[model samples]
Each structure stands twice: as C-alpha cells, then as structure tokens.
Target: MIISVRVQQILLLLTLLVIGISREIIQLELWALPLALLSGLVLQGIGDSKRRRKWNIASVTISCLSLCLLLRTQNPYVLFYAIFFTVLSKFLIVYKGQHFFNPTNFGIVVCLTVFPNLSWVSPGQWGNYFFPSLALSVIGVLVARNAQRLLTAFSFLSFYSLMLLTRYLYLGDPLSIFTHQLKSFSLVIFCFFMITDPRTTPRSFKGQILYTFLIALTGYLLQFHFYIREGLFYALFFICLLNPLINKLFPAKEYQWAKKI
Candidate 1:
C-alpha cells in the first residue's frame, strides 16, 4: 500500500526473517498492522505525495514490521502508542533547537511506565534469558538492521558487554554476569532497531560511529553498574539532539553505491 518496489523487497526479506525465527507464522502477523501503520504515517508525512519514495517507504515499513516481529509480542496498540508519543515528542519538545528525546525512545519509556507487566521483550536481558534472543539475532541484527548504522550498533553492543564483563570480573563472579549478558536478546534488538534509527543518528559515517559509541557506552554504564533500566531509551534520546549537525560537521560522500531499482 505504501509504495511498490522497495516495500515489496523489504517485505520479502523481513518475512524471510520472521519465518526463520518462528514455527507459527500467525503469531508474528499480529504485530504487523500497527507497526506498518505507524511507519507509514511517519514516512508519508515526510514523503512526497506525487511520485513514490521507493526505498524510503520500503525501508521504514520493513524496519517497523521487523521490529514488531522481533519484539515477539502481541500488543500492537502499545507499539502504536509508542510511535505516537515519539512523533509528538520530536515536534513538540525542542530544546535549543533540538528535540530532547528520540520519539521511539520516549515511546518505550512511556511504555515502561504504562505497561510494566506487559509481555514486552527486550533483547538486552541475557543469561537464563538467552534462548529467547536467538530470534532477535537473526532478524534484528542480521536482517532488519540498517547496514550503515550497524557498526555503531555493534560498537555499543560490544562495548556495553565489555563493561558488563568487567563488572562481573570485578565483583568476582565473571561467569554469572556473562551468563546474564547472554539473555539480553532485547538489548540486541533495541540496538539494531531503536538505537540505529536514521532520523536520530548522525548522518556521516565517522560521526555515526562516534555517535554509536557514545550511546553504547552510556547504555553500558547505566545498565551494568548504575542499574538504570532506561539506558537504551536515554542513550538514543540524547544522541538524537546532535543529529542535525551531522551534515554540517561531516561531508556526505555520494559514492555510486546505491543501485537504482
């Protein structure tokens, strides 16, 4: 419904990821509608009305759909509410010419307060929680993730894990902490899905790398030692404040890389 080529391309790829992760296809479908709607709204609002935005619509649609599937939950309304709040936050609260929080991060925070007991899955909760994360590994990291932003995502993941690993060793129980890190499937998913949001991150490659590292480092510091539950959301929220300056700070190289479909 959004566009044609890009939407189809991303849909096929995302569907492949979902099928790879689940035995029951219908369970994943429950999350599709609301997510698609939310992404559609975002893309459509910013997109042109006359001609189609081939890859952009497809990218956003796949991203939202993949997030829903990777989330492995049934509350479409929660995701929708999160999307609504995120968009509202972006336009509503500008501080020194920048919005205070990434819309998605704010939405997730809102969800935590509103639906703590809800079956929301976070990929960061590892250890005994490890098994549930494999799906995310395949979809969130491998497929749904934007390749450009992944380096930053992985940098944060690796650095954050290292901090946790350090804490475990410091506390004299390295194995225990390592095990707990394994169950953090949602954290992994969150990194690829939420942290790497194009609208939030810096535009240049180097800046994006730096941006990713900071977000990851912050998330790690809060999660491992300070025990801040809202690290991911906080990390992304603050990082987004710097997104605008990316183009001004770093020159965007237009290599003949993106093949026109």
Candidate 2:
C-alpha cells in the first residue's frame, strides 16, 4: 500500500512532535497543539465553504503542525493569530491561482515581526542530536522525493551548508562549527517541509535552484551580519516575493500532487 505524500508528511511531523514532547524538548502548553490544529482545520473549512471548494485537510494540518513545532509562545491568542494569518494567506494572497508564500513560513514570520515579545522560534529547541537529525534527513528526503520537490530541498540544504562552511572558514573556525550547525533540526524542517512546498516553490527546476540560492545568501547575511536568529524564516518570506518573477523567467510545467491511491 502506498501512502500519499501529504499523509507521509503528517506522520513524519507527528512523530517529531511526539519525540520532542516525550523528551521535554518542545516547550509548548498541552492545549497549544490541539488549538493550532483545530484552528487551522476550521479556518480551512471556512475558506473552502466560502469558495465553494472541498476542504484540504492535509495542507491545513501540515501548516498547523509546522506552527506547533516551530513556534513558541506563552499566550494562546498569539498562536491563534499565527494560525489565522497562516490560513488567511492561502485564501487572500494568490498569484495566478498559486500562493507564493509558504503558509507556515508566512505565519511564523508574521508573528515574529508583529509580536516579537510574545512569540519566538527556538532554533535550538530540538538540540543537536545525531540520531534524530539523521532520521529527519532520511525521512525528509523520502517525502521530498515523493512530492517531486527533492531538488528544491537538496539545493537549499547544499547552498545553506556551503554558506555556513564559507563563513566558518573566513572566521578561521574549526570544521566542527559548520558540522554542528547542520545538526539543527529546525533547519532540516525548514529545508524539507517549508522551502520545498511544491505549491509555493518555483515551477521549473532552474527556477527552484536559483530560488534556493537566493534564500541561502539572504539567510546567511541576516544571521551573520544582522545578528538575527530567525533569519531563515525571514529569508524565505522575503525571497518568496520574487517567486512570480522566477516562474515567469524559468517557465516549466507546474507541479501537481499525485492523486491519493
């Protein structure tokens, strides 16, 4: 039996959530996950009803899981806002029938910018665990491969890693510095899930490669030069603005998800 890519994604995220919660790594309230998931589903249902379309539970759930995993906040209202805008963006922000911004990325960035005091993303929340990182990479690769967005994920990781290595070498730091950075599970999630979102990424292979490069360069600058911890999220958010131009320049067949078996 074959599992749909979206189903695979949901399972993978659920596993990560369980691992994080079990290990006491994810610092979230007991009610936060349910609230995010429920809010996302209900908002998506409302959008579908308004548009006279079917509810996309998979996509909405994925976005909500992303929020629950990455975002940390003391206030429930902030979480609601993040999920609200996350789902709202999918309906309001469209370009030629496609949403350029990754929904979860948009939500995270928005909250970080708008409610910096109340909301934050802990990049180190997952810690530098070897086994979990390896598992994430292996499973993420499979999911990206099935979704046909492996190129986007691989290119982003490669480019981002190169940037880290270059910066470390410039500073005369040991190679371990670079290797340690690669252990960030948050970065892995961003690469495999957020950046590789098929509906949001460039349609053409060339466009996707170029897009990843830009994200890497911008993220590096933001993290190193500007001293921003949440640089990658902002990097993706801003670079997504150029996606329409990227698609226009490197026109190719638009990606369509495989029908559920």
Candidate 3:
C-alpha cells in the first residue's frame, strides 16, 4: 500500500492534466500534448539504455505531464525540445546519482529563458475556481503526506505566507490585495507538488526546513524585488545547486520509493 503512494500521485496528476485540457484550465493545443509526451518518453528511454538501467515509465510520464502543465508552447517542435531536454537533464546532469533540479522545472526554466517568445508559463492559467482549487490542495496535501515530505511543504508555505504578510504591511497594500495573492493557484501547485519533490529535496528534517525557507525567501525576493514572474521556479533551480552541500552538512538516509512501500 505504501509503495503505491507514488503511483497514486502520478495517476492523480495525469488525471488533472487531462482534465485541465478539457476544462480549458490548460490552454494548450491537442498536438502539443502528444508531442511532448512522446519526446519525454523517447528521450528517457534512450537515456536509460545508455546508463544500462531499466525504464521507469511512471517517472517519465509524470515528468512529461508536469512539463505540459507548466509550459505553454504553441509550437510542437518547441514542446518537443522542452521535454527532450527535460528527460536528458536527468541523465546528463547528476550529483552522487541524484539529479539536483526537478526535471520538469529545469525544462520549463530553460524554455522560458531561451525561447521567451515561443515558450512561456501562464502562472494564472489555472484560474481561481474555488472547488477545483480546494480539491487540488487537499489531494496535494495527501500526496505530500504519503511521501513523508509534508514538513518541507508546510515550512515553505508558512514562511512564504509570513513573508507576504510582512510585505503587505510594509507596502501598505490593501488587505484585499493580500488576500488575493494568498489565493494564487500557482503558489498552491508549487508549494504542494513541485517543491515537495522528495527526490530533489533534502533528506533530513532540519535540512528540509532550512532548504524550504531559503527557497521561500529567494522566491519572495525575486517576485517582489525583481518583479520576476517566474521567481519561484528560478529560486528552486538555483537553490538546487546547493543540494549536495546540504546533504553533506546534514546527512540523512536517501529516500527510496520502493522501500517506502
């Protein structure tokens, strides 16, 4: 039962991604989705062979779907390149056998930076549908809890909220403005799903808390100080470079999906 936790998460995310298409939550064309999926799967399969490892279709599927959700590309070639690089990053970039940056995030960041006009992120595309937002939050919390990374998720959110509050008071922003920002769909998806990725995050409880706080701080600064809309993704991308150092300073057992089951 415990081992099925990740499988559950994949299924849930896949369902949501598909539903997002039908419900117009994700405004991507039909062809782009298939192209991205094929690109991710094919690249991962070839990469796995080079390393002489068996394929993990589940992980590849999740990565592909996640990229589709976050990256908005009108060109099929652009989508393919985004997913192709995302899959390749896992094999090409490594530290002590673990990929530092989240694969989906790495791909999204690269596309947005390299092809600003071609590929973009619509952070507010998910919109503020009350019931769907509540449902996603609840399921995300459950998945994070099952994965035993709830501490990271909670800490990031708590620190992020506190920072937002402080900024509101300092700027004399309207209470309504503060309330609206807190209800952001992007923040919900990021805190619960993206940042809580057990593989890329710290192994120790203390380390996880510290890592999440710093990510929150960096994201806050980027968003407010620099006015970078993709601040949260960039924060995680740069902070991931410190994963090895964090593991060395606060050593803990590496998390394994199979063992958890």
Higher-ranked by TM-score: 1 or 3: 3
Indicate the residue-level lDDT of 70 in model 1. Answer: 39
**How does model 1 fare in lDDT?**
0.57
Candidate 2 or 3, higher TM-score? 2
Question: lDDT per residue, candidate 1, 1-261, as tens digits?
Answer: 434434543665465455545634325554556565665566445543322434344444544555454343456666666555655565566654445455556666666667777635444323245555666565555443355656667766777777777777778885966777656655665766666555455657787777777777777767656877666666666666666665458756432214221
Give the runs in model 1 whose Cα sits over 4 Å from its true position. Answer: 1-56, 63-80, 86-103, 110-147, 245-261
Q: Could you give candidate 3's per-residue lDDT for residues 45-117 as a string of tens digits?
A: 8988888899878888888888888889888888887887788778888998888788888888888888999
The lDDT per prediction is 0.57, 0.88, 0.83
How big is the positional error of residue 144 in model 3, measured in Å on the Cα after superposition?
Answer: 2.5
- Model 3 off-target regions past 4 Å? 1-3, 129-131, 259-261
Candidate 2 lDDT over 93-170, as tens digits, reads: 999888888899999999998999999988887877677788888888877654347888889889999988888888
Q: Could you tell me the lDDT of residue 71 within candidate 1?
A: 40
Q: Is candidate 1 or candidate 3 better by lDDT?
A: 3
The RMSD (Cα, Å) of candidate 3 is 1.9
Best by lDDT: 2
The TM-score obtained by model 3 is 0.93
